[model samples]
Target: MKNIIYVVLAMLIFASCEKPNKIAFVNNGTLINDYQEKKDVEAKFQLKEEAFRKRADSISQAFQEEAQKGQTEAQRLARSNRKKAEALMTGLQQKQQQLQQQMQVEQQQLTQSFQSEIDSVIVNVKNFVHDYGKTNGYNYILGTSDAAATVMYGAEQSDLTQTILDALNADYKKE
Candidate 1:
C-alpha cells in the first residue's frame, strides 16, 4: 500500500515538472489577405461573372422584342400571339434560370478551387515550417487560424504572411 502511494506521488511530480515544447502559430487571414494567388483567383471569377452578365443582357433584349410584338398586334390575333409570346417568355425564363444555376455551380467550383489552393499553400507552409524549425532547433511548431486562438494577438510585423505568400506565389508562377 505504501509502495503504491509512493509510485503515484512520483508520477505526479514527473508530470508536473514536464517542460512545455516550443510552439509557433500561423494566421489563416494572412493567406487570403496577402496572397497574390488568391487575388488572381478572385479576378478570374469576376471575369466569368461579367461574361455571364453579358449573356443575360442579350437574352433579356430578345425577350423584350418578342413581348413588344405581342403588344402591337390586333386584338383577335393578339390573343394567339400573346399565348405564343408567353410561351417564349417562359422558355426565356427557364434559360435565365439555367444560366443562374450554371453561375451558381461555377461560383461553387471557384470557391472549391480556392479552398484547394489554400490547402496546398498550407501544406507547403507546413513543410517549410518543419524544415525551418529543424534547421533552427525548434522542438515543436503550432499553427493558428485567423482568429489566433492560442495566440490572442500577433503583430503584423511578426506575421509570416508575406513570406508564405511569396513562397506560394513563386511556386504558382513556376507552374
Candidate 2:
C-alpha cells in the first residue's frame, strides 16, 4: 500500500512537470497584407501594369490613325474601283480583329503572371510563419482571416499576428 501511494505520487509529480502545449493564432489577412515583401511585390507589379497600359494606349492610338488613313484611301479608290475599295475595307477589318486578339492574349498573360507572383509571395509568408512557430516552440498556430475565420476567438495574449508581422518585415529588410 505504501509502494502504491509512492507510485501514485511519482506519477502526479511527473504529469505536473510536463510542459503545456504552446498554441497561438495570427490574423491571416493582417499577416500577409503587412508583410514588406508582399508590399514590394505589389508595387513592382503595379508599375508593370501601368507601363503595359501606356503601351496598349499607344498601340491603340497608332491603330486608330492607320485605320483613319485606310478609310480615306478606300473612299478615294471607291470613286475609281469599287471592288478594290471593298477588299481594302475587308483587310482593315481583319487587321483590327487580329490586333484585338493579340491585345487580349497579352492582357491575359499579364494577369496570370501577376497572380503567380502573388501566389509565390503568399507561400513564402506561410513558410516563414511555419518556421517561426517551430523556432518559438509552438505546438499549433492557427490562422484566421476575415474571409475564413479558422480561429473565431483567440485571447489577445495568444494572438501573434503583430509579432509575426514585425519579424517578417525585419527579415525582409535584411534580404
Candidate 3:
C-alpha cells in the first residue's frame, strides 16, 4: 500500500512538471471567408461570371428574336400549307437546340475555370496556415469549422483567427 502511494505521488509530480504544449486554433470557415485574398479572388471570378452572363443574355435575346420571326412566318404558312409550317417549326427547334448547346458549353467552361482557380486559392490558404504554425512555434494549430464542433471547447485567448488573417493578407499582397 505504501509503495502504491509513493508510485502515484511520483507520477503526479512528473506530470505537473511537464510543460504544456503550445497550442492554438483557427476557425476554418472564418479563416477562408474573411481572408482578404479570398475576397479578391472572389471579386475577380465574379467579374468573369458577370461578363459570361452578359454574353449569354445577348445570345438569348438574339435567339428569342429569331424564334419570334420564325413563329410569325410559321403562322402564315400554316394557313396556306401545313407541310411547310412543320418544316419551319422543325428548323426553328433545331436552331433553339444549337443555341442551348452553345450556352451550356460556354457556361461549363466558365465554371471549370472558376473551380480550378478557387481550388488553387484553397491550396495556398492551407500552405499559409501550415507555415504560420511552424514559424510561430506552435505544437499544434487545430482547425475548427462553423459547420461542426471540430473544437467544442477552446479558450478565447487561443483563437488565432485575426492573427492568421493579418499574416495572410500581408503575404497576399507580396504574392
Best-matching candidate per lDDT:
2
Count of clashing pairs, candidate 2: 0
Ordered list by TM-score, greatest first: 2, 3, 1
Score candidate 1 by lDDT.
0.65
Q: Provide the lowest-lDDT 10-residue window in model 2.
A: 33-42
Give lDDT tens digits, candidate 1, residues 43-152: 77678668766876776687567556644443445466767656655665686677668767866876787678667655765676677667655575455675656667
lDDT of 1 at 52: 63
lDDT of 3 by residue, 11-90 (tens): 99999998889999999888888888778878998998899889989988998998999999999999999899999999
In TM-score terms, candidate 3 sits at 0.85
Error of 2 at 50 (Å): 0.9
Model 1 superposed RMSD (Cα): 5.5
Clash pairs for candidate 1: none
TM-score of 1: 0.56
Worst 10 residues of 1 by lDDT: 69-78
Each model's lDDT: 0.65, 0.93, 0.89
- Indicate the TM-score of model 2: 0.88
